[model samples]
Target: MWKSHPKALPYLFLSEMWERFGYYLMIGIFTLYLKDVEAGFAMTEKEASDLYGTFIALVFLTPFIGGLIADRYFGYKKSIVIGGLMMGAGYMLMGIHDKTMLYLAMTLVILGNGFFKPNISTLLGNFYNDDQYKDKKDEGYNIFYMGINVGAFICNFFGAALQILLGWQYAFMAAGIGMFIGVVVFLMGTKHYGDKTEKKGVQEGDMPFYKIVLFILLPSVIFGVIGWLIKGIQSDTNLDSYIFGSDSTDAFIFACIPVIFFYGSLYFKAKSEDKRPIGALLAIFAVVILFWAVFKLNGSALNTWADRYTDREITGTTQTVFNSLKLAKEIEYKKDSTELYDAGFRLQKENGAVKKVVDYPIYFRNVKEDKKPEEGSKISIWATNLSQSINPGWVIILTPLVVAFFTFLRSRKKEPSTPTKIAFGLLISALSVLVMVAAVQIGNNGTEKVSVWWLVANYGVITIGELFLSPMGLSVVSKLSPKNITSLMMGGWFLSTSIGNKMSGVLASLWDTYDNKANFFWVNFALLMFATLLMFALLKQLNKVMKEKGIN
Candidate 1:
């Protein structure tokens, strides 16, 4: 893959691979660690999911600011190194096992990711923009995305194993170690960055750094405070009446109003030649936020599914293989003891009744009748984190095929415009949610352990959508953005991602609300369908813009 591409491509790819290894490893069990009741923090599902959403949302949000600093002062390499070190330190500190310390650690990771994420992606695109490789830009990003999933695919086993053996803290420390390793690999490729680090000089219509801080950043803080203070007045709950979700979520959405306005103003204020392209990019960003809202459920809602509804039992031949690999987590059962319930299935009861009467753990709902333990008997089961790998595994397997499919279309001169690709992506992703809806019915609303195949199939379908949409979103911004505002536009892309991530958290927090379970999947399906319709409605205009920009 590196044979004909820019020298920087391989280094960037490997660096990202390692970085994702660390990131996904940490995330694979982040909420589980937070709500472990015995060994983990005893946060309610709503609390954990809310915080999870906020953490990941901020993680993507910071890249906007980080991208600006690198564009103006820090430069890509220095920004990446500093960001990586900070992240590594944060992950290590997360092992300290204190709530305040965890918040501090999350703050560091969020800020670190902001500095690191956009710069690395921008740097990779910079390599592809050279005349020798410009045509391969999309292919290059696809290859880079595959690298990201390779890390995501493998990290869960490490998380599961470490958590099983040494507890949550050591698993977190392993995430830190992986991050340091990524930094080491990135530094190993310093020579490759030399040509691509050339900064674009100031261009017309660019806002000054101080002006941006005063107008956008300062306003965002003020808006967030106002939102928080006014939160509960709107809803019956002390918090819900204020916004669609939690107070933090409401505040997050309100704070983004300024940032969103900033991006819109960019289009309004751009030079005439840049206006149409900016408009097209903004439209796509708005619609694709829906796609991300569903896709990001992998970390929240889907993670919950694996933890609760999915049958994780490994037995017979499969159990042997998993055990030999040291990848299986065995859950021991005790007679008359209260069972394990992850945040997803926990419920509260009113009217002075015991909330949880049956001692049966939630996971047993789906165990095969023949395999389930008798009353007052004990049984062991496999690890939960390993379920996180299914989607990334599909990405690793399917990226090449998707790339080849597009390549074949290119040869016929029938390749879809980037916007069209994204539209199809949303449509396909909607179908993946439908698969989960079927899984819900097939499993009889979690009365029995559903086949693991359902999770695998759902992930497989969605990975195709992800491949079509995600990297293309980045490539579109790089191609469409004015040189002076490229990083800022990149921030817009992440801003959409941030919003979607928070929505995913909100949705995940509602896991127990839907008694039918399939209702939850239907909600996801509806969201994606709405996004697809919006994208299709604007397709002609977006295509025209792409044509004018000569991207097809």
Candidate 2:
């Protein structure tokens, strides 16, 4: 894989692979750990989803400051090392099983990711800036993206096996080990990236560090607090009364106002030669939020689908192999005591009287009584987190093919521009949501178990769109950014992703509100479709800017 790439590619690849291994491993079981009534934190679905979304949003959000700090002071290597160690500690700390410890651990991971995530990619972008490797930039990012998914693809098996065989704590410990390994691998490759890793100090007209803190960062914090503490005039539910569904949502939105202004201010302040490319990037950044908003449902709404609606039971050879590998666990069919609580399916009164509702480990609340397994019988079902791997799994399988397809277009001198590809990517992704819409109709809207193939198919289709859009976004950022603020622009790309990810949480939190799940998918489709149209509307102007900048 590194044969035609830069000398630095292998090291960056392995480091990122291990880093993603840890991050995805933790993410795979995070909500499950939180909602496990027996031994875990027993949070309700809304609460868990809220925290999960907020955690991930902040995880990406901090990259802005991290990128700035790296650009101005620490450089990529030092920042990355610090970030990796912090994340390793955070993952290990998750095993403590206290709420305060959990919050503290989550804070570390969030801060660590802020430092780690954007810099590595920015470092890679620095390598591709050379004329020798410039044309291969898209291919480079695609391969790098594959490295990320490789870790994402493989980590779930470890997460699943460890959680099933030992405990969540052991699984978390494994995640920490992965982070440590990533930091080690990164150190070994220092010589290759030494030139690229230097701190990029501020250039002429750039905002001073203190001004950015005072004007952007400090104000964002104050705005977030205002959003959080202000009482509503007349509503009962706090979320409904707020501006954007919940306090976190409102706070995040308010906090972003200054950041958004800062980015816009960049275009106006840029040297005339740099303005159009920056403007084009800002346009693309805004449009791609819809993509991430829908795509990031993998861990929440989609996980719920796999848990409740999909048929996970296996028998004979499949069951034997899965059980032996710790890919599946036995959930005994019995009236699980009230102790086996899942708040999403907790008891609700009916007929003016209260009755005991046995919420079992298996999500069988909507399953017909006759269709359920016999009491005391054991059934082996695949781990829910295994479903989390489907996107990365598809990425692993299809990346080479997608790369080859684009390479073919390049060979013919007819390749689409990066921006054009993103427009079409949005279109294809919108179509993928239709697959879920069909799944809803087939499963009778979660009333009965549906074939697991539905989940597989949905992921497979979205994977194609993901291939077209995601790394291409990275490639464009590398291609268009001014030399002095490359990492800052990279951070801008992820900042857009951060906002989108938070929206995903908001959307998933509302999953129970929809009577027909298909409508939920329709909403996703509409969002993506609108984004697609906007991209096309701006395509000509974007292309002109790319030509002016001598980039694709």
Candidate 3:
């Protein structure tokens, strides 16, 4: 892989690998940590999922500003370094365990990711811009994407071990260490970047930074404030009063209005020659929002499934190996000591206040009577966070095969356009939701635990969809964007992701309302199918734009 690619590819790959190691490690456990009764924030399922969604949405949102700043002033390398340090600090500070400190830490990670994520991707695209590597850009991005999954795949084991052996704080600290290591590795390869790191600076007809601040940023802030303050409808979950499902969701959606407008203006304001490609990019961005909306549920709803609905018990050799690695923990069966719940949760009065608490031993509630352990016996169960690795593990396994499949198609000049791949990706991802639907049926809608293989099968299918769409999205942005604002366009891609992520949260927050869990998966399936149809409808125009650009 290194021999065929630029010298800088290895450095970028390794730097990205470690960066994702930190990010994924933190994300894999974020909601679990929030919902943990003893060691975590003690938030309900709805609260944890909502906050997780908002946090990730903001993490992606800041890239819009970070990418613009890098394009005009700070340059890629400086922005990445600053962002990495901030993220590392944020991860470390999360170990302090105070709610205020957690919010402050989350803010740092959000802002830091904005600076680090888009710029690094833009820098890698820069290396492939030269004619010598131009034809290899898609392959280059696939290889780079594999590196990201490599990090995502391996981090969960580390997280599981740290959380089991030490605690949540130690696992968080490990994420900080991983980020710092990424920064050191990145600096080691600075000379390899050379002029690729240079800022593009302002170009003719470009909106000046101060004007953007005044027109876009200021309005976004004002809109967000209004969104937060204005009450919309009365609902069981909206006692605090919010337009959307939550205050954060309402604020985030409103804040995005100006940024969305700015991207729209780019198409209208573009040089006549640049108009079509910009429009095509924006259309693709809009369609893929649904893809992310469904795909990103791995962190919230799916995590909940793995934790409560999956059969995670291990015995014999498997249990022994996992125990030796500290990847599994023992839970004693003590019915008398556990609180009995009428449903999924119980309302308890504490200090004259009624609070709803998740039943921690809810895992055993659905087990077959014959399989239940004796009162004093213990069962070895794998860590729930390890389930987070399934998607990335599939990515690591399937990437080379997918690349080879595309390479074979390219050899015969039969490869589909990037837009087409994305369309199929949505279709395939929609199918993955059906697997969960089936699992719901087999598990009797959470009355019985289902086999873990169901989760594996679901991830295997979706990972293929992810491979088709995600890296290709990056490749398309790099290919279609006007040279001056490449990073800014990359930000647009993340902006779509931000919206989708928030949408995922909103959907996940409704999990409790669905008495039949299959309905939740069906809703997800409908969303992806709708996106797939829309993408297919626009294929001809998108392909025409690709042909106009003289590349695919």
Best by lDDT: 3
How would you encode candidate 3's per-residue C-alpha lDDT over 1-552 as one tens digit per residue? 688788889888999999999999999999998887777877888899899899988898898889888888999999999999999999988867799999999999999998999889889989999999998887888788888999999999999999999999999999999999999999999889999999988887566889879877899999998888877878776677678888888888898898899889989989999999999999999999999998999999999999989999999999999999999999876564335554445556678776766644667878877889998799999999999999999998999899899989999999999999999999999999999999999999998999999999999999999989997898799789998676578778988999999999989989998999999999999999999999999999999999999988
TM-scores vs. true structure, each candidate: 0.92, 0.92, 0.93
List of clashing residue pairs for candidate 2: none
Give the alpha carbon lDDT tens digit for every residue of 1-552 in model 2.
577789989889999999999999998888778877766887766767777888888998899899889988999999999999999999999978999999999999999998999889889989998999998877788778878999999999999999999989999999999999999999999888867999978877566889879988898899889888764555665545777777888788888888899899989988998998899999999999999999988888898888888989889999999999999999766654443344543443568664545434656665667878887888898988999889999999998898888889999999999999999999999999999999999888888888899999999999999988987898799789997676668878989999999988888888888899999999999999999999999999998988887877
After TM-score superposition, what is the CA distance of residue 248 in candidate 1 from its true location, in Å? Answer: 1.2
Off by over 4 Å in 3: 130-136, 235-237, 270-273, 337-339, 342-360, 483-485
lDDT of each: 0.83, 0.87, 0.90
lDDT of 1 by residue, 427-462 (tens): 999999989999888888877767778989999999
lDDT of 3 at 492: 85
RMSD of each: 3.5, 3.3, 2.9
On TM-score, the candidate that comes out on top is 3
lDDT-wise, the better of 2 and 3 is 3
Off by over 4 Å in 1: 198-205, 234-242, 334-361, 365-370, 375-378
